[model samples]
Target chain A: MSVDVHLAFPPLARIGDPLERVSTPALILDLDAFDANVGAMAAMAKKAGVALRPHAKAHKSSAISQRQLEAGAVGICCQKLTEVYPFVRAGIRNVHISNEFVGADKVAMAIELARHITLSICVDHVQQVRDIGAAADAAGVTIAVLPEVDIGQGRCGVASEEQLAALADAIAAHPGLRFGGLQAYHGGIQHVAEWDQRRVAAARSADKAAAYVRFLEARGLPCPVVTGGGTGTVEFDAASGVFTELQPGSYIFLDGHYGSSEWLGGFRPRHGLFIASTVMSTAKPGMAVCDVGLKGVAVDSGLPRVHGAAAADLRYTAANDEHGILHLVDAQQPDRLGERLLLIPGHCDPTCNLHDQFVCVRDGVVEALWAIDARGLSQ
Target chain B: MSVDVHLAFPPLARIGDPLERVSTPALILDLDAFDANVGAMAAMAKKAGVALRPHAKAHKSSAISQRQLEAGAVGICCQKLTEVYPFVRAGIRNVHISNEFVGADKVAMAIELARHITLSICVDHVQQVRDIGAAADAAGVTIAVLPEVDIGQGRCGVASEEQLAALADAIAAHPGLRFGGLQAYHGGIQHVAEWDQRRVAAARSADKAAAYVRFLEARGLPCPVVTGGGTGTVEFDAASGVFTELQPGSYIFLDGHYGSSEWLGGFRPRHGLFIASTVMSTAKPGMAVCDVGLKGVAVDSGLPRVHGAAAADLRYTAANDEHGILHLVDAQQPDRLGERLLLIPGHCDPTCNLHDQFVCVRDGVVEALWAIDARGLSQ
Candidate 1:
């Protein structure tokens, strides 16, 4: 069902120009706020005792990761092997793959990465340990392995102490694998509404992690690292006396969904990333049209919210493949045509995925542009 | 936060010989099914005597659009000017920007596009019309304009005939602008749960569209084209005798959400596109870990469902950035590691947004690999 037909366009546009001048449905990133955000997160992590292992999955860009490292992150955490390749190629030295890998192709890729950097990954089963051993054997290198323990979120990792120990034992038995640490993460706790509730939830999960660490120690295995924590529950994780490292992404470009939550204890969400859009239509009384559609900002967490514009009460109501519908939150005048507006996406990560270059803007002027290096790397 | 770190391979696998060679989290278009789907939609349009103006927002690939034009479509509807640019550059002829253009840059882009192709765009406001006219004047090209009418989806577009007429009159009065037609689209009706309800809803919206067409005709405006209809309501739209052209996308990749909907009474969802993913981990008793995740598939319409290999009732339960938690729908067993599975994404468009290439396969053999040429063109 090919529908390839070209529609012409106006030429190249300069930054800070009205909506008409900029390209339609562009992913715009504010450089000033972004730099400030990086500085702020790094400062916060510096004050905290735990290491800041910045999650690269949020913004899979080597440029962003390099900035994070420069700011003071211990390393970067890549979500997949394919995602890590570009970063490693770009000279990111320390990386933790926060997910499991399966095939020989992926394993080979991971080993290849480890040869250049301090690479580590998580595991939740014995078979994974065996596969790691096999890959490491082929690569002639011992790979560090952390058994992922499911404290909550119900996604992956070992569920019980017995299972965790068994998996760890399997890693110990494998000549090419090392029992590096434990991944005690509660992904669901990050989205909890209340701050205290989130803290308590994190603490409870930490209890399981502590017990698992103890079990491993009793078996004459040293659990040097017990890592886990997201942007949602990092504070609790830092003070929980359980986690050795904290992984939090999205603190840089805090999204509307996460900003709306009261989980982070009064931390004001500094809107760093924004989808710069122009009001395409305002013929309707209470509705306005924008170029940012489903292809612009992600709608998984919800549609992006309009920011610092005349239509302050404007809410993104509906989205098609390429156009977003902004409706008045309160019955006010429709948006003016060609008005430039900044939108805070519902979810930053997926929204970022819809773009290539982060149009970094500073003080209403165009600044540096960062390429999303690891974007769309599915393999 | 980047707590999910996985760098090990699972030992067990259940996929057969050939499929295992395929890449991870790949978007596969079944050529046989895709051809049938295109032919079926074309046949439906031919039978209904309505011109087809398939929306390219769903596929955004020029290759696919060429196929639609070859299938007897009158033209194609693009969602954004940037999206239209690639197709135009590729020499796509007739195009209708089903959405409005706002800024000078975008309007200029739109005007430049008009110079090469018969270009039409939608406007819901007079100011947008003026801006487009200005851009067209600069480009030295005449641009066709359509006033988008809000049929049911409370997005952009005018609500009543009076509003439509005012916008239409404004476009007529503007230099370098022509009153092309009315963009009467019912976006909400596409997901109706019941067949009778969907048909009735389509009829009601069609009536509104017919009224607008009659209103324009009475006012001596050329209303030759009235475009808007999706895969869900194409049948009713073709029979309504109101819309001169149908702009239906998503007919190629019949997703789980569309398949689950009762919007189209007797429409059988041909599984043309499938997210071919591998089972990464199966350590849990009732769950299997998959390579597909929030980064692989769109969950807006709902979670992806298992298409074939029904040994386990697989439902995507949770997702991180790169890993999906597949819950066993049936208690049969967890999927063996590295097993290849076809997942029907919740929404085809967004899921397609996550990948870079469409690996076209015919009868379990590799056919063609089409780069999503226009993917990630957010701006």
Candidate 2:
């Protein structure tokens, strides 16, 4: 039987349609706020004299990446190897795999992509270096290798200078591998609530990275680039004089978690991303249920907040697979059925991964639909 | 510029490959366990004399739905209108949208799908009834309407007998709408830890549903089908004598959240679904980072558990965007880099949504790749 074309549903909104015409539970992007965020981050990085490599893991849209490039971003950083394909296909020249990976499949993918683009990847273990280095050598293509140092984030990175040197040496030993620099990213400090605490943490991370750089320099190893920092710590890292590059992903579409944090005066990104949801049910007295839930928005950080609503006015309390329970604090003003509400997702990265495309809107009119090309390219 | 084929990316695993050869952070299905679970649920429903209409929101795979149908399921239940497209395209004749939706797009979709297959939908509001009913009438197709009653889950469904009757009456007013039955699913009680408490909650829900049925019958309305129950409360709901059909979605792939619950005898479903993850980072002592994280698995319920490992031995303590922090309790048995582990996801539905396809494995080898066709069709 022929597959019905309707099964592969059309985009939620057309270009000329109004905001109300867009379907519910859609990932809506405000183009005005987005353009301002892109401009702000680009200008901040240029003034700071630090290369800005926005993490595409947040948006996963090649169109957004192209806009970032046009706004003067150096390159884009992806969290996975497979995630880099879309950007590479979209003509992004410089790409870095921010996380480490193992296995022959990853090595083959690295070699395949390195042939076409300026590819760089991180390594915490010597085995990972040897695996990719060998494949790169066989392919006769040079791949940039950055040894991720565990400055503070204890998840993925080399803990000691000895281990870092070994990984660097392994990369140097291979003919097709080049020592890129040190990756001193501390993901834990990105969401520190207090400004002072987050600044101190970023300073400490920079200090430790400086120490690693000194050790590598003393051993006659050139540390060309010291790339790190996130949306929370970008200001501190850019001013630290230790980090040569800033990798801030969430600044373009500030999520609820990032919005809750106190940012420096120069760089507070606007809330451009939102989940357009409809009040599907108003059954309970103080509760209203919306169509967006775990499937449409990511709740890993916390529950999403209603856009432009005060903390006391409305609160999203619970989320099921396909429903979000909204607690209406104002008893007199009840949410009507079919009433549209914009939800600012708690976390932007994984929330972008949950949707197929973004319904880009400008002045309450749908402007474009950017495909989340790497939505499920987690492998 | 032409889009590269590699940008689309291929499946993580191929048929006839060994399980270890499958790419990391892939959704893996143990076909043996899946067959057993499907057979067990089918046998129980047959013995209980209740129609088995498994929910497709959990799997979202037409291949699995075909298997469920072959195992004697009457039809399938979808959480959204868009989600039914794949199963319908695969020739599943019966479908029930077990949730409420609004908008002209949904009505158009309902009308289009009802033209080809037996389609049933739920509603707690008269507007929804009128919206979909008028469209169905104009299209000259009869769509079954099930007025969802608030059995206990306060998220959706009509609150009172008056509201339920009004919705049913509204459905009857349209020439193309038929009062199929009442939906009395209590989602909150599905995850209750204690079996006794869950049983009591299920019984209460059944009692409330029976009352609504009587009320409707006294008013000369036919309550033909009483469908509501999940994997956690299937046994209780089937034995309650009030529900004519059971809608258990997660039984085919018992997740870590459901596995932690206490189940009655004769109704324990084995964990048939898992995330095949490889340890990518072992930099920190007493800790290992796996490839599966928030993007690969759903952590809304809880963190995924290491399959076949004791709670004290290995624990998935934290989840980042693309990394799972595995806390090694057994000091001597640290997770090695490149080592593969099966992860039982915290919740199956959202976790399944995060993947593109299920790597079906049997006898430690990949048997097939089942596309998660309706994965992001949450509109």
Best by lDDT: 2
Which CAPRI category fits model 1? acceptable
Q: List where candidate 2 sits over 4 angstroms from the true fold.
A: A1-8, A309-312, B1-10, B309-312, B332-335
How would the docking of model 2 be graded?
Answer: medium
Q: Compute the lDDT of residue A276 as modeled in candidate 1.
A: 79
- In model 2, the Cα lDDT at residue A169 comes to 86
- The whole-model C-alpha lDDT of candidate 2 against the native structure comes to 0.89
Off by over 4 Å in 1: A1-24, A263-269, A309-312, A329-335, B1-17, B262-269, B329-335
Tens digit of lDDT per residue, candidate 2, span A17-43?
999889888999999999999999899
Error of 1 at B38 (Å): 0.8
What's each prediction's TM-score? 0.90, 0.97
Candidate 2 versus the native: TM-score? 0.97
